[model samples]
Target: MKTNRYLPLVGGLLLSLGSQAQTKLATGSQKPMPAAEWIDADTGHKIVRLTALDGANESFYFHNNPFVKSLGAAGDKMVYYHSSPAGKQLYALNLKTHQSEALTRPFARVHGEIVGKKRREVFYQVGDTVYATHIDSKKTRRVFVFPADFKADITTLNADESQLGGAWGSDAEKEIYRQYPAKSDFFNRIYEAKLPRTLFMVSADGNGQLTKLFTDNAWLNHVQFSPTDPRCLMFCHEGPWEKVDRIWTLDTKTKAVKLVHKRTMDREIAGHEWFGADGKTIWFDHQKPRGQTFAVTGANLQTGQEKSYAHTRDEWSVHYTSSADQKTFAGDGGYPTSVAKSAEGHWIYLFTPEGDHFRSEKLANLKTHDYKLEPNVHFSPDGKWLIFRANFEGQAQVYAVEIAKAAI
Candidate 1:
């Protein structure tokens, strides 16, 4: 859709005013794949099990708005960080054979990207340093390292595959945790400190020459480059949704920064922002009075226009993801905690947003477990499949749903 075509004053805004839900039997025959079972869901989609560990530590979820792309080679392989009793590790699974190859082990909290046109190599971080490992040879190389005082967190590769982007907070992160007890234990906070928080864009190879794109006193995070515009990137002020403006965009060429979805009211809470397929519009979830109500919103970065649909009451998602075309969106209400406290029970959902209205269908009903459904929900490059994390079996696992063209 044209970015400027959604202007409110021009009578062009598409507004979905309220919430609704539907459940129906899914249609589709099961595909023959190893270590996998298929079930027909009420959304007329087929859900495929990518992993089959029962009551085991099978989590593949990484983080919300992750900088790394998990699916590789047109959905033939999926790279994910998994935690087990043995240790935390990274693996790549063959979608058809159900066979997985370990890429690295003894790794700490991680985010990874599969590189090259052939996707034979992977790059990931093991703390403050980023490393690259060969998928077949298991040989590794150190790609980049942050300053001794800085610890890089989430990482992403740019559109041209020439640069990598990431953000790190100053030493204030430790003091924040010490002074305030975090109810969720997740890293979302805005503290009163003078420590420097910087966003870096590093070269993808060799010494990985690093470039500081922006820095601020606030917590900077979720650094992602536009998929089509290499010089443009987006980051967020990480904190409680209502306390921060939350999103901002930066131009690497001109070194300019612009606030995205800037607060327009006293109680508006917006976060989990991401760019559309064309980079013309940005999507995020917004609500007033915190958890009471919310809507999935889209804003034109170039024209200053906006549109929203899929409204809901206290039951909306804490994070969301949409297809490249912006025609379909999926999310869950699960918070960061384990399934016991923050489970969605209703599980994942798919929304088909139309001109001022939207239709929602329950895509997957993930029963309660030790893991909460995460917000890594994403569509394949071709939009033929949707992928997400769930713990329907006890431990978290990744799954994909074959999206029926007619469903959207």
Candidate 2:
């Protein structure tokens, strides 16, 4: 192995992290690890395991958007799923105080940690009922519930927070899901089924005026509204990426459907899309030929232009997220058995956009992590740490790898 010249400097910053966490709560599980930090042996990057204990602790999914930073005197706050003694419950962490407080009673099914940065609340669905729970006050408000006829789920909140976007599958698609409930079993089947999917919007306040925006015989998955433009809603033709032109945007005002990324050559594909902080560009995992060449590509929604920064095959990540400044990026790498079949890819990566390619640095080693639980990475609001969840420590726990080699 080639030695890093910074290893000496990296070694100086090491804080011994045992094979497992040491602190345990009175309830017989590891205590909430708010300040638990360590240097990864393989990469020499500091890794802080956010959650400790047995059950899976999770952060929000990659495309669910911001981890909600309310920069007040109390400091910035981020919400997550914690395996509390009460079972699965919502919890919020105060980064400044390094304190965590459980936010919700265990909900059977909470949709997404769709944090409202301005409102300081998280919007999630419990079954067909939607709720918004305040992070600071712990006050929960029952929002609108889905209508009986609408059999759809809320996907994204619009820029002005006026509307919530969703996709409704035709009965054919629902039946297909019933037959092959497992995604792997029906992923391709539902795509090939080409069942009609409808894109619609409802008042976020639940005033109940639902408007059907667009309908097509395509798998309209990954529905997201622009963070800066409420009028622009993006959705994908979810399927085997190579076989379909995945990225698309629809203007809710004009009902215009625009294909965001077009394949330049046979088998070129794009998916796992997300919007920039300003919502001007759409960034996604891009490959020129399926599992071959890899890059995180972006498209200018206003200019109809695209740019890509290439990376090695082994560096291909299941998901990539940009920093608050859009100056840096992070990736959650695939395991050896993944589609990339990467030999040395089990590490969380920090990527700097350099010319046509990326300058890659390994942040945390995940060689022992179970690939079944994807460590969806998100950059800190201040862009100092990359937060993700992993199961390498025997159970899934949220972790953050310091981007800087040494404490700044």
After superposition, candidate 2 runs with Cα above 4 Å error: 1-35, 84-87
Q: Per-residue lDDT tens digits of candidate 1, residues 1-408? A: 001121111011111112211222232221222223334444445555555452222323322222233343322545665666655676765543445667787466556543433335677777677887766577888888777866675466666767778877666566676776664653544444545788888787756587887788877877877777888888888776777888889998898999888787776788778888788888887776566556778889898788888555423655667776777887655543422133343456677887764566666554442323453566654566667666554456666665652232
Candidate 1 RMSD to the correct structure:
10.4
Top-TM-score candidate index:
2
RMSD of 2: 6.8
lDDT to native, each model: 0.60, 0.77
Clashes of 2: 0
* Backbone clash pairs in model 1 (N, Cα, C under 3 Å; residues 3+ apart or in different chains), count: 2
Worst 10 residues of 1 by lDDT: 1-10
Tens-place lDDT per residue, model 2, 255-315, is 9999999888998889899998889999999987888888999899889888899999889
Candidate 2 least-lDDT 10 residues: 1-10
